[model samples]
Target: MVSQVDNVITIARPSETPAPRAWQRPFLKWAGGKYSLLPELDRLIPAGKRLVEPFVGGGSVFINSDKHASFLLADVNADLINLYQMLAIVPEQVLTFARRMFTSLNSERGYGIVREEFNAQRIDSIERAAAFLYLNRHCFNGLIRYNLSGQFNVGFGKYRSPYFPQEEIKTFANMAHNCVFMNAGFQKTLALAGEGDVVYCDPPYEPMPGTAGFTNYAAGGFTWDDQQALARCCVAAHERGARVVISNSTAPRIIELYKGHGFDLHHVSARRAISSKGSTRETATDIVAIL
Candidate 1:
């Protein structure tokens, strides 16, 4: 059986049918990654010739879903895009350099040194990309934050052992063969959408009330005006015959923004582990809007 809400289609399979195993997992541990919401996201995604992700945070949704023949993944973060580009061009080299860095710089002091080098822009692209991966794994809570001066500023993670995702990197490289990654903002990426495209956006979520909203994934944090602009872009893409799906916090303003644009909202519980304190981490309501 199947159900449709607006244009969003979801399959209701027989109880006897076994769930499909995840095809791939993202190597990076991003803050707002969609790994846990794959089942819901996959159901909402409509069939299309290509999948377009304007905010490809961790590359989990694109990596796991096999519905699209090609992908256009974009993000505002240049370092993240450079890492993906390098992986697509030279997976083995990235794997080798990252493996070495993980082994050599697996301490707090080493982390500080590498963070300094990465911010200083002293290393080549390949090495810098490796350092980015290393910092993402070893830094606190896998945060990719930067200061106003555009320097990597997250502290040491202090993990017992950060696993080197060799297989995950290789898997992403193979998948990247049909992908085009760009270092661009959501507006520019969404403007390119047209017929036969499915745009899935996982932007830095709007912070709920009474919570310290952590939108500073990049230097210029996402603002209310930016969120409004994103909503406008999604509506424009939908009007151009493309399917659009967006994930965001269930903030009142966020809900009102999507509702006003005629998007169908599907709320789901997402366990957020980005909090500094473990006790503060709990299940939060997230809305997946489709048009």
Candidate 2:
């Protein structure tokens, strides 16, 4: 019931894992999802000081993170935050929403109705959360793409399926009960700083000059200016004694953006399988800041 109005960074060391619950599905099809790289995150940060993630995409890390100050989670996407809020606050509503969405997902008409329900209630934090899982379960490629105007644009995908599993709904709901979800910008979440808070930001990456077409998740272009602003906020948090981790493109400009900012740079491989031609895109890396 409390809110983080001031910036207090806390670094928490995660040495224990949460007891496993049933909800076991990734809701959204996040681009830089940490499902595979979880061990790496645990190794670098290890659930230190008040666990915080501003960008908390897909929640692979948050759900998996070692228990900290409960957990503080936030995101700019209203629908996404709604899902978290439903999970944290009123989990049964999420169950109803999930059941309704799944039950009505067979035909195109039913899918459209479900989508309408999601878009219509996206402004409601809890509903948006349940709708998030619903749409992501039914959307094509689990890809959460938005048009320039911010409309969910990805169509249905290959396999005839609904990604939401039966038991996962309740499991995820239980996990949601442990954290606080906010439909706010990443800064608000990062601003919540006290000693030992580990803040990981996976904001939209800065596009390189030569790169052609990249996936755009929001209506906003996630411009260079936004990246710069985020960098400044992160520096401020770091100065306040919070440990920070950020994932960004490997472009020279992106690398320079964090230059001398006190982050230990590590080159990590990324498989750009969005197009799924199965090609490998090397030179991807993660920037870790905790000094």
Candidate 3:
């Protein structure tokens, strides 16, 4: 039997690149996510410890973080969390669903039908992963916003035929397999860590006076109370000897909120919006390297 490390991709087959370390796709397209900002985050990784990312948005850090830790990944979005849980625990099911969705795509109507069909089913990982993919690809600019009723609220994208293949998705499945997946709110995940663990918090960004329209993706926008709660979680984690890092909009509200909260706040510039016409959104600073 070939092990997962076997660097063998048979002819007529690709996309099975052997991963020296497990890397899972961050299952959601978070509005203010920083998958493209890992270089900025690289400066802040603590030398060695088990790793945890409470927000784990698109898993930019969890999947790419040096690969030397007992990872605990969590998110608040149920379907998003379920998709990762499925990828970690059930890759084959996800692959099957991906292929089926690819073959079934004919029109926007077909995509909506599939979403409704899967959304009504029991909380199965495979179906959830496929639905998540479909929404991300078809939804406006890959935003994962939803309606208050829990229906995906992202409008159809400009793409005509959207398809995710079996081989490419297997990578996501293996990622889920490599780490522990959770549906807990950010605090619950933090509560599980201790001295030898490292937690990277990528909570949703807070809006500032000049850039108030930055966060509008999730069904219910994240709140100031949640931000305070996250800061407390980080402080508690710190007291337990764990290192905490946060990537969020460096707005005055956030900066003032965490000032002297025992964290070193550093500002790094980031693009503020993802709108059509590629809206020349404001370039704003976000912070990391929380001490």
Please name the candidate that would achieve the greatest lDDT relative to the true structure.
Answer: 1
The sequence of per-residue lDDT tens digits that candidate 1 reaches over residues 161-253 is: 998888899889988889999999999999999899999999999989887788998889999899999999999998998999999999999
Tens-digit lDDT string for candidate 2 (133-195): 766767665778777767777665534666566465565666666677777786677778656
Question: Per lDDT, what order, best first?
Answer: 1, 3, 2
Residue 277 lDDT, candidate 1, scale 0-100: 86
lDDT of candidate 1 vs native?
Answer: 0.91
Instruction: Give, for candidate 3, the lowest lDDT window spanning 10 residues.
Output: 20-29
The C-alpha lDDT values of all candidates are 0.91, 0.68, 0.71
Q: For all candidates, what are the clash counts?
A: 0, 29, 4
Q: Per-residue lDDT for 154 in model 1?
A: 91
218-254 per-residue lDDT for model 3 (tens digits): 5676888888999998999989988888877767778
The reply for model 1, stretches above 4 Å from the true place, is 1-16, 276-280
| Per-model TM against the reference | 0.92, 0.80, 0.82
Error of 1 at 185 (Å): 0.5
Error of 3 at 65 (Å): 1.1
* Model 3: residue 5 alpha-carbon error in angstroms: 45
Best model number under TM-score: 1
